[model samples]
Every structure is written in C-alpha cells, then in structure tokens.
Target: MRIPGPEPRADGGVGAVAAAGGLHRYQLWLHAEYGPVVRFQLPGAETAVSVADPVLLEATAHIDKRPERLFEFLAPLCEAGNLQVLPTAEHTPWRRLLLSVLAGRPSHERHFGQFAALATDLADRWAGQGDREPVALQKDLTTLSLRMIGAYALGGDAADPDKVVTAFEEVLTEHLGRLYQVPVPGTEEERARRAAQALAHLRATVDRVIAAHRSGGRTDRSDLIGALVEAGERPARIRDTVMITMLAAHHTTGVAVSWTLHLLGRHPEVAERVAGELDRVLGERPVPDYADLRRLPYLDMVVKEAMRLYPPGPYGARETTEALVLGDYEVPAGTVIFYPFWAVHMNPDHWPDPEKFVPERFLPEEVAKRPRLAYIPFGIGPRSCEGAGLAMVEAELVLAVLLKRFRFRPAPGHEVTPIERFVLWAADDIHMLVSPRVA
Candidate 1:
C-alpha cells in the first residue's frame, strides 16, 4: 500500500512542513486526513513513514537506529562519535553505563537535596516578588533544571555551572533555530561563529571538571563525572558524554515542568487539587523530597497528564534495520519510522476527548485500561530515554514546590505556542502571574 502525504515541493520536498514550525500539527493533520500510516520528507530523507497507531508501532519497536541525517545537527556537540548513531554493539554498553547512573534511585536520593534546594530557591524568589509579577516559566525552569543536572551529573560549581549553562543555551539556540532552514540564512554565518565560541567554552568547562575530578581525590565520587573517571573513560569521551547527557537531561525535565504549570494555570481546578495534594503530603515543608515522591500520587498524575498533552520530546525516529510488516504494509529496511508521541497521545481511539486536560485519565485505575504504548511520553523500547526516572522525579518535585508556594494564572494577552526545537518548547515562553497560595 502506498503511504499518503502532502504534495512534495520542488524546493525542499516536505522540509517546509518542519521548517514552518508546525511539524506536530502537520503530522496530526496527515494522520487525520490520510490515516495512521503517512509518509513525508525531512531535509535529507525523502520517504519517512510516520506511524501513529500503537499496534503498528509495536511492529517497528525493535528498530532502534535513529535516523542519522535528521540528528546531524547534534553531531557537532559530540567528539568521541555521534552518540546518537552509535551501532547497537557500542550503543548498548554506553546506554548501560548511563542507566547505572541516571536511572538509579540511589543517585536520585543522593542528589535530591540539591534538586529541592534549587527549586525552593526559585519558589522563594517568586514568593518574594509579591505574587503579581509575570514569571518566565521556561527560562527559569530550564535554568533550574540545568543547575540540578549540573550539580548531580557534572558537579555544577566545580564545573563553572553558570558559564556552562550559558554556553549550552547559546549553542542550542543557534543550532536548533537553524534546524529546518535551507539555503542557510545570511545571518546564520555570524550565529555559527557564536555557536562555535559557545561550544569551545563548553568543552573547556567540561575539561576543567574532569581535571578537578582527577586531581581533587574528592570523597563525593557518586556524581556522573566521578563515576566516568573511575571507569577509565577517555577525556574526549567524557566531555561528549557530559554534553550529550546535559543536552538530553536538562530541557526535557524543565520543559515538562513548564508545560505542566502552563496547563495547570489554565485549569485552575486541577491546580487546586495539585496544591491540595502538596499541602496534605507535606504540611509545612516548602518542597517535596526523595521520600515524599510516593505520597504525592495526584501530583504524579498531573505531571503525567501534562506530558501526555505536551511531551517534551514530542516525537522519536527510528531507521528500520530490516524489512518489517506493519499493519498490512511491508516496510523495507532503511525506511525512517517516525513515532510521534503527540499523535499517539491524541489518538481518539485510545484517549477519549484527547485534547482535554484530565489528570484523572492517568490515575492508576484509568491507566491500566489503555495499551502500554498509548501513553509513552518517554519513548518506548530499548532506545527510550535513560533519564526518564530522573526527569519525572525532578519535574514532580519542582511542581510540588512551586504549586504549594504560589498560584499561577495566565498573564493576560500572552499566548503560549508549542514549537519543535529538539524538545517541544513554548515559542514565546509560558508567562504566568504568580501569587502566594492561600492554603
């Protein structure tokens, strides 16, 4: 069966769809108009098949090679190799090492204090602002997430956290903004130069952290940098690994929290429930800690539902390694299989009233009724994000802290728009007026 798609444009095929900054919407339209299996083009690949049906996705779940050309923009950030495209043999061990650290509950507990303190700092700042000021949700949360990741993963202060995050933001802004642009904008030349500078600064900072780890004989050898050093990894590998982890780690968690807050702000009743949960769980504490995670089921559901609507990394791609049959269609090896989480989350067949913000949909009882793949804010199968646990813990903790301390309401006249920039992000940023919580 021939997969359907929009008419291919002469200048760039379907590249304009992505470049237009509505790839998610376009994909949804494609599915709605053409059915679950739709074909489209990305800059280098002309025949990418986007599979939205959960049952169909299971057929391609084992295909784990990320589409190389599509991920090339991130190539510059790594040195050991394009971490995203490492072969299964090499990728397996690397992923295992990451899982040992990033997915460990012990590591999260060790770093929980640092994460809570950083979140509380932001809450304190907002509380001090007297409740009426507009808070730039993405900007502040991204910074907070970076700080927490830096402290736990790279040893933030020892790594010059401020400079590292600034350089990273510059690098990402420069590269991600140019992701779909063709014929390269004239102004990108200068931006490219700045991106290079930012990259240099980042490498220098990572090198310094590695050096400190080596020379200090530090007692706190539990951080990611220390674990890497103890494992005898190469300096360049360590640098790239740190950058890659930072690249994946920071934005998703931060963006998740921002979107959750944005959704909660628009849905005051849900916000009230979240706040009530926070209050009941920790009567006087300003933030949720490691142990408090299990006690806040409502907060967990709220975060899960928010992610369903605005997944931080909205889509994932896999290049088929072998021919596979998917829902009556035989897809050949080398086909790019696009798994759009946003589309799956909104599939009317799986989710009733998919666009509505209903945290109850994620309650344990409700969740058990759906297909496992039906709610993968984190991608499914082996290639799913290793830091999923950490991101959730961080997001929930931050949400509890902020909501307990403040009530967020949408600032008048400001619109929040989601765009794909590596991660799904608000184009103008989620702006909200903060006020001290009454209860």
Candidate 2:
C-alpha cells in the first residue's frame, strides 16, 4: 500500500514497521496494495498479516486466541482480557446476551450520580485554580474517567482508584513501547515476574470483594458489584467478567475522551459551537447525564470528527477460521489478519477535506450519504463495541461539561502526536491552557 509522503510501507516481506500517525494517512495504503488484506510483522514475535477486509475481519475477531494475541501487546494487566481483549467466542456471548450492566438494572442510564459527580468535581477544582494556566486537559479528563469507571465497576469507594490507574498505565505503556524493539529474554522474564505479582494483588482484590458480597454484605445498593455478585450462580465467571469489563471500559474511554479534548482545543470554532449548543441544551450551571446527551447534537458531531481524525484504535485484526481469499490475497489459519483503523478512517473517497477538522459534516443528511463501514469509530458488525452506547453518553456528557466551563488551546508548543495500536493516544502530551469562557 502506498501513502504519499515518507511514511513506512508494509515491508511486503517481513519485519516491516510503520510509524504512528493518524489513520487517514494510512488509508491510502490499505486501499491500494492490500485493498482489504495486509501483512505486518513487528520487530519481535511471529510474522503477522493485516486486513481491512470487513468480512475477513469478522472471522478474525471471532478467533479464540485472537484476543489473547492482541492482549500480549497490552500490559499483562489486561492479559486477563477486558471485553475488548477477550477471545471473541467467550467475550461476545457474555457481552451480547449474558452481561447486562449496560442493558440491565442500574444501567448506565441510571448512573447519573456517578457521571455528574465526576464532572462537578472537575469544574469545582478547575474553577478555583485562579490563573489561566495550561492544563493537560487530556490527562485530567483521563483521570476523571478512570475514577468514574472504577466507581461503576466496584463500589463508589473502589480501592485506591489512582493506584489502579497508575499500575494499568505503567503496564500498558511499557508493553506498547516494547513493540517497536526486540524483546529480550531477560526483559520478558522480568515482565512476567511483575505481572505475576500484579496478578496476585488483583486476585486478592477480587477475592475480597467476592467474599464481602457473598457474606451478606449489602449497602442497600445495586451497583456494578451487586449485579455481578448475583450473576446467575456462576460467581467465578461473573466476578472475572466484572474485573475484565472495568479494564476494558476504563482506559479506552479515557483515551478517547482525551483525543476529543485535543480536537476541540485545536479547532476553536468547533469548540465554540459545541459550547453554544451546550448552553441551548442545558442552561445555567448545567450538569451532564444520560438524558442531556441526546440534546448534544454539536458535541456528538465533534466526537465523530475527532474519532475520524484520531481514532483510539486505528487497527483491529482476526485469524482465519479456514482458508480465505480476498482481493487476491490469501491467508490460512494462524495468520494474524489486521485491519488498521487508521487506514479506513481516512479514505479520500469517504472523507472530503479529510485532513481538516470539521464536525458538521457528520450531520444526519451528510452521514446518510457515506457507505456502510466507511465510518467505523466504534466499528461495525457483530464485534462492534458493546459499550458504544455508554461511550457515546460518556463522551457527550464530558464534552458538554468541559466546553461549557473553559476555553482551551494547545499549549505554546505541544503537539498531539498519536500512538497507533489498540487505542490512539497523544505520543507526547496534550497540554492546553483553560481560560474561563467569559463570552
């Protein structure tokens, strides 16, 4: 695949690597050479294949070991698998039918207290800071999402929320960075040893919650823990599933929110428009909740544009169940077929002025013109994100709260470089100065 400029090509053979960039730049390549199927082999491990071929992607995502291999790129913190990283067969069924935190009692809809508390806390703190100092809006927002997700997963007073996030990021960053380099045997051993220690701690943490809930511990509550505690007699799977769910929902949401903030900061006009809409939808001292998100049409558009520009996950892959042929590319079982999110998000045919930051184009009339699968921020088909509903609410709500309160801009020289993998992130930092929107 050919992307005009100096970006790396798909090594065609093996050991070819590409630099981290927005998916739009990579879309040209995916459609050109690979059309739908592509190959990539990181610095270490086995040779792998990648594909944006939607049909083939479905089968790959369904592979039992697919999630596990993907997780290896993640810190072992998620090795246990979050909803996103779990093997397709195991995760899909439970996520689709069995588990119902999103579609069940105390659904995200019923969780206003948690989301509001987070937004309020952020406003109160930032409001009092006095000076218009540049804040890493992304960093602050990520912290908020992590804590809120913890509250949802465990109880309101989930154990050491900061510690949980710190450990998770350490493992995630460490593992992702290691991908660009060779894995030393000694380093692998060290990571496993650390992972074992973390696993022991995590198991202990899960055990305590299980023990408490099983032993008639009741807070007159029916939060995430309570639902899982009574997950239909299969206590172990339920508990494991809860732990994994938090892992999936927490960090992914945080990174996505961070990117949104960066996009709004960079595009001041869009930021102003979103703020104006927030005012219309929610008047003085407005707080975000499930109900308010629907009224946030501008905020929703902004989010879609951000996801289009800087997708949290630019690529997703799966393994073949049997021999498959697509666009003249053939692959057998055990081949890692990849579908780069970065590739699909930026096809010129699909996106006009693809490099520019424009949100209104996502309006219903315009969106209806795009082909199916052309815009897949949350992905498509069976393997699409189960938490998309929750994510949409979370994003719109956070954007509403933030845009209403501050006028943010990129720091003097901060560049929002992104890392391409399971999620996209600012490679350096998203530093922004937040001035009161005194308009």
Candidate 3:
C-alpha cells in the first residue's frame, strides 16, 4: 500500500536499516514522532519494500480476515510452517482451537507453581555460588525456561534436560541466524545442500524425541506435543506446529528471563523490591503455583517493563496481498510491512522515561494511562503469541524464587550490550556475579 512520499531524495542516500539511526533512535520515532515509517531496503537484495508504521499495525491473527501474509524475512524459521506463519487454510482452525488449552484459568494456575519452584531452585543454586563466581546468565536462564516448558507446561521428560536443551538450542540458533539474512548469500547449490542437511537434522532430532514418547508414553505430564498428537487433525502440520511452538516457547522466554535477571542484578533496588514482594506473598513457601502468580504483581510488572525495554522477538513483518494504500503513500503488493517492536517499546511517548528499569510503570494505574496496543510484550491481537501465558508464568515464578534466595550484582568491568542477532541477545553474554543472601 502507498503512504506519504518517503522516496529517495536526490541530495542523499537512505541508510541501510541496520545503520538507520539504530534502535535507540527508532524508539524516539515510535514515541515522539509517532510515524516516520521510514523506507528501509535490505542491502544487496530486492526482498520486498518494508514499512514501519503503527497506524497500519492491524492485528492479522484472524483466519478469515487475514491481515496480510507473513513476509519472507522470517523465512527458514517461518519455514517450519508453524501456525504463526501458516497461510490461511484448513490448519487455521488448529491455531484457533489450540488457544483453549493456552487460555482458561487453571492452566495458568497449574503453571505458576511450576515456574516458582524452578525459579527457587535456580536462586538457591545462585545463592550458593558465591559473589565472585561467574554465572553465565543467558545459558542458565535459557536452560531453565526451556526445561520448564518441555517438562511442565508442554510435558517432555525432564530427565535428560541437558541433551534436549542442547539439541533445541542448536536447531533454534542455526535456523534463526540464517533466517535473519536476505536471500541465502551462499552459492545456490551449496545453500540448498546446507538447508537440506539442517532441516533433516532438525526433523530427525524432533522425531526421535517423538518416537521415545510414543514408545514409553506419558507418566503424568503432557507437553504441547502430546496435545498435538492427541488432537490429531492434520498430523504432519500439527507436528510441525508443535515443533515451532517449542522453538518459540523455548528461546524467547529464555532471552526474556535472562534480560530480566541482568536488569534486576544491575539495578539492586528493583531486586530488593522484588524480594520484598516475595516475602509478603510467598512467606516461607518453597515455590509458587498458578494461584500465587496473581499475588506477585511487582514481578509481573518487572517482566512487562523488561519486555518493553527488550522484546523477545524484537520485530515481525507481513506482506501485502495486493496493492493498497498506507497513509499518504500508494504501495504495491509484496511490500513487507516491518514492525520494530524493540523500537516501539522504548518510545518515550508510549513509555515515560523509556530507558529506565521501572517495573512500576506496569502497575494498574500506570497501564491504564496507555493505549491497549501500547504495551505489547507477547505482541498484540489474536495472532499474537500463543505461549504468552506460559512465558509469563515461567518468568514470574523464576524471578520470585530467585529474588527470595539471592542478590545479584553486575560484575564490574563487564560491559553488557544488546546485540541484534536473529533475536536480541546480550552481546557480552550477560555475566552476573552471584552472592548468597544472609538470611
């Protein structure tokens, strides 16, 4: 669709998206300017015309009303043909129907306790690890989050957590890195070979896990995969759908949880406040349950703030089905509409003092001040994240349990910077010095 004329000016060339003032400046545009909707062309390829307008940010999750097609920029990762990226088809119902499990009150309650317990275990480990020790924050958080999803929510065996974690991590990062780039830069034949090999590896690993479950079957817990198999509509599609959820539910939560930990450690007052909340709600309890999650409002707010500051999957894009208009500019079909969430979350207009770590901003009164779509962590609308509830429960419990047991201080001389990978990651590898609490 066309919008205002953001055509190339004669006097100067438009900078590439990576260098286009970066996320720091884009955040300003999202809040203060509202809609610069700058035209960004990925270097060396004619993938599609990209837009960054929030006005046109319609929620496209509805199967019948399909907003637009998921753009190819998310390819390879989108290659799994997961429900998130699936074209509107018979499988569309799967995405909708699956929501019942993710929704409903008790599922949320069931998960909160699991999350709190895991968080406590993690904190206890951290508390015992001495202040001077180097705790690889990302690895720890990612492992814990993934395990929680696989074992508790999605119900995979927690017995071999490390093996599953490694396989999951590898498959995710490998595909994610490739998907981030435009047109596989390597030679065609070579690229094809690599792609085949990677997909085969991923499918095989996932299949083996599936087979193991089939042979042995569930003891007491059921994972998302189990739900998919039991549902049994489109077997192939359903399997792929569950796999994609695993990948999404896997790393995104980990990155978010890690970011929260680093932020809390760096800002001790926030940690202290989080600890105080735990004291009032948790008392001497070993862990929290789904019921206890609601009581930890401060922890919830902290995660909400963390997500705004640093989104798990920073952006998403959709392709226009046919030529249409966006604002003042006339656009053609195939244009990729890019929504830079990281940029939007940091906008001061939407969020006061955007850069600060202020969980209090998520308090009911503070949240009431903003628009509905303004504070999207799991994203906005129906097609938003299916695992949002699962992610939140996992995070809150982890934060609460950890805060109750230990205090983390940022290691001196360690510069933690966010590097834009397929997903935003702590470039310096988020190292937090661990120390046991006196109590």
Candidate 4:
C-alpha cells in the first residue's frame, strides 16, 4: 500500500513545519491524520517516510546508515568526517571503541566524583541566587552539562573547563542558529569567523589532551582520550571523536535534567514523590554517589517519564541501504526513514493517557507490557547514542542533587514552550523558583 501524508507543499515542507510549530508537532499531526507510517516532505531529504509504530521500527533498526544530507549541518564539527553519517565499515569499529569507554561502569565510577562536584557547584550557585530570582534552567543546566562532559571527555586538568565550555557554545550557537534560521548576534561573515575560530580552539584543546595522554603513557580504559590513543586512532580521528563526544553529551544531558525539573515543577505531587525517594535513599547527604543512583528507582522513573514527555533529541533519521518492509509498506533502497521519537512515546496504544506525568508508567511491570521501542528517548538500534548510559547517569545525578536540596516551582508569568533545536529547548528557557527544602 502507498504510505499516507499531507499533500506536497510548494515551499518544500518548511512552511508546513513552521505552521505546525515545529517538526515535533508536525510529526504528531501527520501521524494523527494518517496512520503510524506517513510519507512527507522533509526539507533536506526531499521525500521521507516516518514510522511511529514501535514494532514497525524494528524492521529498520538494523539499517546502520544515516541520511548524510539531513545531518550535514553537523559536518563542520568533525575533522575526520561527520561521525553521525560515517559509513558502516568505519563506523562499526569507531562505535565499538566509544562504547567501551562511555558505556562502562568503571568510567562512570571514576568520573562520578567530578560530576557530583560540578552538579553541587551549580546547586550552590543557584542556592545563592535566592528564591526571589528565577533560574534559567536550560542555560545554567546546559552549561553545567558542558562542564561535566568536558571533564569527562578531556580529563580534569587537560583543558580550561570554562574556555572549552565557552568555545563549544560559540560554535553550537552559530551552526544551530544557521540551521534553524534563528537570528544569532553579529553579521553572517562575523558569525562564521567566530564559529571557525571557536571550532579551531576546541580542536586544539582536544589535540593538547591527546598529546598529554601520549606523553604521560597512561592507557587507562576509564580515560576517553587515553583509550582512543591506545586503540591506535589517528590524531585527526581522536580529535574528531572527542569533539563528537562532547557535542553529543553536552546539550542532551543538560536538557534532560532541565526538562525533568520543568516537568517536576509543574507536577508537585510527582516532584514530592521524587523528593521523598531522594530523601529516603540519601538521607543527610546533599548528593548521590554512583551507588545511590540504582537505589533511587522512583527518581529514575521520574527522569524517564520526563524524557518521554520532552525528549532531549526529539527525532532521528536513518537511510535505507536495501529494500525494507515496514508493516504493509515496502520502502525502496535509499529511502529516508524518519524516527519520530516523540510520536512513538505518545502512542496511546502502549501508553495510557500518554500526555500525563505519571512516573508509575515506568514501573517495571508497566514497561514490560509495551514494545521495546515504545519508550526510546535515547533512540533505537545500531546507531543509537553510545552515551545513553552515561547520559542517564549524569541526568539522574543532577536531578538527585537539585531535587534533594530544593523544591522548584514555575516562575509566575513565565511561559515554558518547547521548540526543536539541536535538542528540545524551551523557546524562552525554563525559569523556575528554586527554594531550599526544610530538613
């Protein structure tokens, strides 16, 4: 059967996407009007097929290639290649190497102390802000995430953490702003120059870290650059890997924690449950250790539920290398397969009242009832984020720290609106009044 979607628009799909608020909302509209699978015009890819059914997604899960054009926006960030769209032959091994470091418990344990200190610092700063001033959760939390990831990827003393954070933000603001057509400060030429310079500084920072690894003769698996060097990765590739790792980890983790706070602020009862869990799990403690994470299941559930509602990276895309059948639809080779993650999470068939903020939905028993892909905030299949485990660790730790110390309420008169950027960002930023909790 031919897939269903809206009529082709004259301006390729940009106008429709804008009309629907953003791509996330547009996907929801398309799926609701059509069915689980819809054919639509995606600006860069031209014609693309979006699959919202979790079960249907399994057919395309093994396809390892990403559509190069769609992800070309990120090409400037890498020197070896755009890591996102690397060919399978090169990507498979690269992915395996990254997973070895990023997905391991040893690495997380080694970095836990640093991550906790960074999070606690942010909380302390927020504490000093006083309850009268609202904190910009997205801005502040994303900065915190950049610091954590910088420390994780480049090591504690390898680079100036503040400089790395500033450079990365400069580069990201320029590229993402251009892609979204959001007006960034400065002229086009000036913005491009600034982005190029920032990108160079970041690359040099990675190079310096790599040099330190080689000179120190340290080959610990827990160390990202060290592992890459030990694995015999070339300087360019190693630099690219660090750049990509930082790029991937930076905004996503911060937004995950920020969005969680945004949800918890609006849902005090749920927030109370999360706070209760934190208190019971880490009584008399200000922050959670690595061991304390697993024990705080309710907090984990709250983070998961919040991710389902406002996924950090709301959507992903893959390209078909061969003919594939998604349910009744047989898509030809080279087809663009869009994964509308938000739509899948909101699919009412699996999630009852999918819009509600109910952490119990993630209770072990409830999750077992749904398809595996039904709750994919990270993504699905081979090309899914290698940093999933670490992202969860970082997000949960930050949430545990903040939720344990304070109660967050939405700032009066401020609106929280979700807009699709590199990640799901609040259009005006999530402003919340954070007051300390009474012991």
Q: Give TM-scores for every candidate, taking all chains together and pairing residue i with residue i.
A: 0.94, 0.81, 0.80, 0.98
What are the root-mean-square deviations of the candidates from the true structure over C-alphas?
2.4, 4.8, 4.9, 1.0
Candidate 4 or 2, higher TM-score: 4
Q: What TM-score should be assigned to candidate 4? A: 0.98
Candidate 1 pairs with clashing backbones? 131-434
Clashes of each: 1, 14, 18, 0
**Number of the top lDDT candidate:** 4
Q: How far is candidate 1 from the true structure (C-alpha RMSD, Å)?
A: 2.4
Best TM-score goes to which candidate?
Answer: 4
Error of 3 at 193 (Å): 10
* Residue range 1-439, candidate 1, lDDT tens digits: 8677777778655556756557787778778988888877655677689888987888887766988887888888988888988889988888888788888888888889888888988888888887566989999998998888877767654446787778888887777677745244447678889889999998888788888978987545457887788878899988898888888887889899999999989999989888888888899977777999999998898899999999999898889989988786888999999888999999999899999999999877888898778888889877899889989989988988888888899999999989877789898999999988874
Residues 1-439, candidate 3, lDDT per residue (tens digit)? 3332234433232253345444434333533443545454333333333333344454322213222333343345443453455665654566665665665455566555556666677776776667777888887887887777655533543446565566566555545546554344567566556655655554555555556566776422224555555565444554466556666677678788788988888788888888888888878875765677788888888888888888888765555566666556665665555556776676556677778988888888887887666666675554577778767767776776667777788877888887666567776688888775555
Give the per-residue lDDT digits (tens) of candidate 2, residues 248-322.
666666677778877777778878788888888778866765767778887888888888887766665555557
lDDT of each: 0.84, 0.63, 0.62, 0.92
By TM-score, the better pick of 3 and 4 is 4
User: What would the per-residue lDDT of candidate 4 be over residues 1-439, giving only the tens digit for each residue?
Assistant: 8888888988999999999999999999999999999999999999999999999998988989999999888888878889899999999999999999999999999999999999999999999989999999999999999999999999775547898899988998998898998889899999999999999998898888888889999999989999999999999998888888888989999999999998889899999988888888888999888999999999888889999999999999999999999888889999999999999999998888989989999899998999989988888888999999999999999999998899999999998889998898999999999999985
As for TM-score, the candidate ahead, 1 or 4, is: 4
Candidate 2 residues lying further than 4 Å off, grouped into runs, are: 1-15, 18-36, 40-49, 53-68, 73-89, 97-99, 103-106, 157-160, 166-199, 217-223, 232-239, 327-334
Least accurate 10 contiguous residues by lDDT in model 3: 59-68
TM-score of 1: 0.94
